[model samples]
Target: MMPLIADLRNPAMRDRHWKQLMEEVNKQFDPHADSFTLELVLDLGLEHHQEAIAALSQAAAKELSIEEALSKIENLWETLPLDLAEYKGDYLKLRSVDDVYSALEDNAVALSTMKASRYAVAFLSTLDTWERALSHISETVEMLMNVQRKWMYLESIFVGSEDIRKQLPTESSIFDAVNAAYCKTMRELQDAGTAYKGTMAEGVLDGLNTMDEKLDKIQKSLDEYLETKRQAFPRFYFLSNDDLLEILGQARDPLAVQPHVRKCFEGIKSLEMKEVGKEGRKVHEAVGLNTPDKEQVPLASSVICAGAVEAWLLGIENAMCTTMAQLLFKCYADMKKTKRERWIKEWAGQLSLCSGQVAWTVECTKALHAMSEGQKTAMRQARKKQTTLLTKLCDMVRGNLGALDRKKVVNILTVEVHSRDTLDRMVKANCASVNDFEWLLQLRFYWEAGTDRCLVRQTNTT
Candidate 1:
């Protein structure tokens, strides 16, 4: 048990054996009843490993010594001569014996005094501690720089554009916190006049962690905002965050979105944009779907704005839905005159595609224009009409199936086939999807040529 505990001190070994240790513990104690955690088991093992405890104690002591030394250096730097300060920057940049000689030639007196200082002696005496401390401070400084740069960029964007500020109001407080932290840290570092002061070092390290937390919060908020937009117009999901940001930031400029028009709309290759009215408002009024002939379809004009782009895009989708619904009804009307097998197949395919678009557009528009109660009522009515059309299309197709040729109906029922194979055959023969066939198959009874039978059971019924 002692040997196993010692072996577990190695991190690699502990990770590999973690599951085995848990299983072994479960044998003696009920994990559910005793509520035994892995932490408790590790603590038990660690208590017996006195040598590991000693090593940990020594590490913590070393860290304390380094901090004390740094704190003393910060105090000592105040009394140190101005010449000594000149050496501080150059000495910190030193990497080798050659660099030390090069720095000495530039500030020989200060370099000589710095080399003999007690702080320098302490640094040399504990090279490992100094290395770890310096590395940590460097990493924290780098993090601070990155956070400041990002905040500046985001701040400039929001400050310069009133439209963006109004559109994403939730980001105001988060950015304010980031701005305050960044300014406070920068002020402290500037007042200290040096990066190596212990107070600034500790503060910056703590600030770096805080910035990381704030950065994560900002990302979550941004994701939620983008997700809401995507829900309103699902095509926005295909765009990257940068691409979406660019479109939103320059929402007033219609041409800025021209490049991404194809990505957001499937059939559209580009938009025909123009300025109109006394206000000179830009609008996307037409989309050129990349057909083989390259014909353009005009959409209802929508004035571009930071918050209104989603509504504009949904308007285009709603237009497509209306067109598709009309085409589906036209197919249904044509079916009444001629119940040809090919015509039924084409109608089924159109119904399937049209139904999906109609349902999606109705839901999309509802959320996109959620603030308008009138618009919601209008969408509800539109959805009802589209639903009725879809139902009629399905019913007409099913009726046409009942009127199939007598010989084709016999050939289908008598064939030795699995349910899956039967559905596949029916889909291919009728040029409909498996869904359409399944809907038709739910019927328990069908009459054909003056005979009644359970169509799916392949049984005769008087």
Candidate 2:
């Protein structure tokens, strides 16, 4: 046994010992020998072979263990497990020679009487199991290493640089910087998910979901903050509901009310400009906007505040457009009513004067013709001045009647004259001569549904 052990320690001696043992076994075993004796000898030889193989396996395992220990000390296999769990159970179940030898010995005795072919088959089967087990261990180690590397990469993304770290949400705030960073990271993670499939994809998706949760929380906080700001600065945030209601109530003619509403809008715009300018100046001063690299430098808080202000400004502008549409309609109604009344009174006074001149001319045509050349020139000048005044008044009235419907004008005229008969009588009484009657008829049509050209023709004929 000692010699066998000593021989087993050396390569050449071990081979020679195995050769000599086989020779002795062949010499000892004969076809004439009893079956029990042959079986016992074969079993003994098989047991020794198992013991030698076990010793070799132990030495190899010890060397691998020492190497693994050194590797651990160097931190070379940091993510790898230090246990033999992958090799345990069905594949290479026993860790030591004693246990393996005992287990094999029990099976070896039963297989001692079996054919050599059967024994060879069993040995090959065990080797195959060990080979598959080793392959599994290799794959598992690689997977663990990949997972560890991915974990480190994910952690680095959050704390890689000062700027990056600053972008992450702290306990107090989750405004511009954090929001921007979250958006950027979310996009990167989505890209990574597409780039890395299978196992790595799982990790990437997990990280993305985590980031999404954080962003969701930050968004909720930001929304709350913005709401508070809107409440605190109502004028800057939105148009007042009461003012909008008032404008709606007053609107009568949508087409004619625009000019008045536009005036209001201009006033609101001026106020917004002043407020934005004032707030922007304060923000600039606070964030050192005079710095040479101000564009590059991210003034996160100031930028966030400015964004809120700008959003509010946009909201108010939209509201004004909507509100003024309604308010302009109201202004158009009021202006049209006032202007129509004033125009009627002025036209009546002018008509009375022109009629008086026509009546005078009709009653004293011969007397006027009999006057001196200078008197005739004075009378002609007076009539020309009156005609010019009438033309100017007609132009003013036409301009003030912008887009007013013909039906509305007729209704207003009917109300003013009390009756159609009264209006006809007035027209007849105003016409003192042929030209005067023509001018008066033109004035009636102009007030009803006629264009400025009608009055132009009347003045030309005069």
Best-fitting candidate, measured by TM-score?
1
| Distance from true location, Cα of 189 in model 1, Å | 5.4
Backbone clash pairs for candidate 1 read none
Per-candidate TM equals 0.42, 0.21
| Model 1 TM-score relative to the real fold | 0.42
lDDT of 2 at 82: 25
Tens digit of per-residue lDDT, candidate 1, span 89-134: 3211111223223322333343344445543443454444434544
Lowest summed-lDDT stretch of 10 residues in model 1?
Answer: 82-91
Q: Residue by residue across 230-264, what tens digits does model 2's lDDT show?
A: 46544423443333223222222222222223233
Superposed Cα deviation of residue 348, candidate 2 (Å): 26
List residue ranges in candidate 2 displaced over 4 A: 1-202, 233-400, 403-462
Local distance difference test scores for all models: 0.49, 0.35
